[model samples]
Structures are given as structure tokens and as C-alpha cells.
Target: MKGYRISLIATAWLATIGVATAYEIDCPTRINIKSDHPELEATPEGWQVSINKNRSLLLTSLGVYSDEPVKLFELKPEIGIIDGKKHDLTWQINSAYDENGNYVKCSYNGEEVQLAKKIDPSMKSCWAIYANDENQHTTAKLICSTSKLQEVE
Candidate 1:
């Protein structure tokens, strides 16, 4: 009975590891980010990333309250970068929605910051990620992805 329980626990742990690996974000090594462009293009004169192992980056318009979209990526001692500088992304999602939503709340980041839309059960996406260089607000580093808009009951 002891061996059987141990085997079950090991299997469950392995499954959890697999799930975490599936959620890893794949970022480009380099891309040209220009203001008023359509999307991120491969260019030598663009932003380059020096990814730091075992770290996460939650990048927002740091030190100011603005409507820039939030980005959540893995980080370490170093991570994402842009404009010839290593990005020092330090913001974290500390809340969600309800009493148990504190882990994803955008409240602590900035007062005037634009918050991402919370995912609902009915929401779905194309799974294809994109980015455009349009200064809809401040910077043109917005991620341009398509998703189905569901009608809330």
C-alpha cells in the first residue's frame, strides 16, 4: 500500500510539471519595434532580448500611471529588453477578481494603467500572437492578437 501511494504521488507531480511547461511564453530574440508600424518585424535596428534563465517579467509603464497593456513573461536576474536597454520589469499580478482574485489584481501597478481583460469561461482565442507599432496610447509595443468576443449572458 505504501509503494502504491508513492507511485500515485509521483505521477501527480510529473503531471503538474508537464502543465507548467505547456504555459511557457515563447518570445522572439529580436524584432524591430517602430511607432506607427503594422507589426513587429525582424530588423537589425530593433529591440533585442537577453533572456535571463529562471526569471519572469511583468512589464508595464513603470513609475507612471498610464493605459499601456500589461505583459507577463518569465524572468530571472535579467529578461526582456527594448530600445537598447535591458528591461527592468518588476510589476507583478497580485490579485484577480473576487476574494480569491488578489493574485491577478492590477490595482498595485498604477492608478491610471490600463488593465487586461480577465478571461472568462466562454472566452476563446486564435492562439496566434501578434504585435503592432501603433501609438494608440503611449508606446507602440502593444501585443496584437485576435480573439473571439463572447456575448456575456
Candidate 2:
């Protein structure tokens, strides 16, 4: 009878642990930038830049070429004012892959931004851009391609 009770208690504890783990949220990794405007730095790995409070860009080299800086990702504000009018900004990933596989994942304020997986064959590159607001949220692409990327309007 004591062994049966111990088994029951262990099973209940394991079930609780499983439930807690299943509900856990997976978060993306965030890079910390120290400057507010045009913070540019070059390291052996590659280059990083923060254009302003609303924009951050990173370029990493795979060492294919000596001087080429590959564009990895960019973060920008979702909304902006243009001509004294409010305008939505666009986010784009010009190139997201190479010969191996998908190579780009963009994020804003610590959240991953969904990008279209459309590869352009003619050019040896992939890129994308879009815009959103503080209250708006976007989805991510399941597959990475360059041809399917669309400009935000």
C-alpha cells in the first residue's frame, strides 16, 4: 500500500512538471546595442550598426570574400511621420540564404519578425523590408524564400 501511494504521488508530480514545461514560452535571442544613432562597429566576425532609436542592422561575413559584408538582419520602427503625415514603414530582407540554407532571422524589440521565404534566382542575394506599429503584430514564414517576399504597403 505504501509503494502504491508513492507511485501515485510520483506520477502526479511528473504530470505537473510536464504541464508546466509544455506551457513555457520560447523567446528569441536579442543583441544589445549601446548607441542610439548610427552606432557602427567592425569586428573579426562582421559589422553591426544601429541607425537610430528605431533601427538596428547587422552584417556577418561567412568568410567567402575578404571585404564583403553580408546583410544579416535589421530592426526598425513600425510607424513614422513623413511630410507631416503618419506613414507606415516597411521591413524587408533582401537576402536570406546562400548555397547551404536559410540564413536570416529578423527581430524587433526581442521578438522574431516573420519574413517571406522567396529566393530570387537571377540575383545572388535575398532581401526584405516591412513596417508595423506599436499595437500591430506580424507572423513568420514557415519556409525561407526570396521570390515570395512582398513590399509592405
Query: TM-scores across all candidates?
Result: 0.19, 0.20
- Candidate 2 lDDT, tens digit per residue, 109-141? 433232223222232222233323353433222
Q: What is the lDDT of residue 70 in candidate 2?
A: 36
* Clash numbers, per candidate: 14, 28
Cα RMSD, each candidate: 18.3, 16.7
| Model 1 Cα shift for residue 128 (angstroms) | 7.0
Flag regions of model 2 displaced more than 4 Å: 13-104, 108-134, 139-153
Runs off by more than 4 Å, candidate 1: 21-153
7 Cα displacement, candidate 2 (Å):
3.8
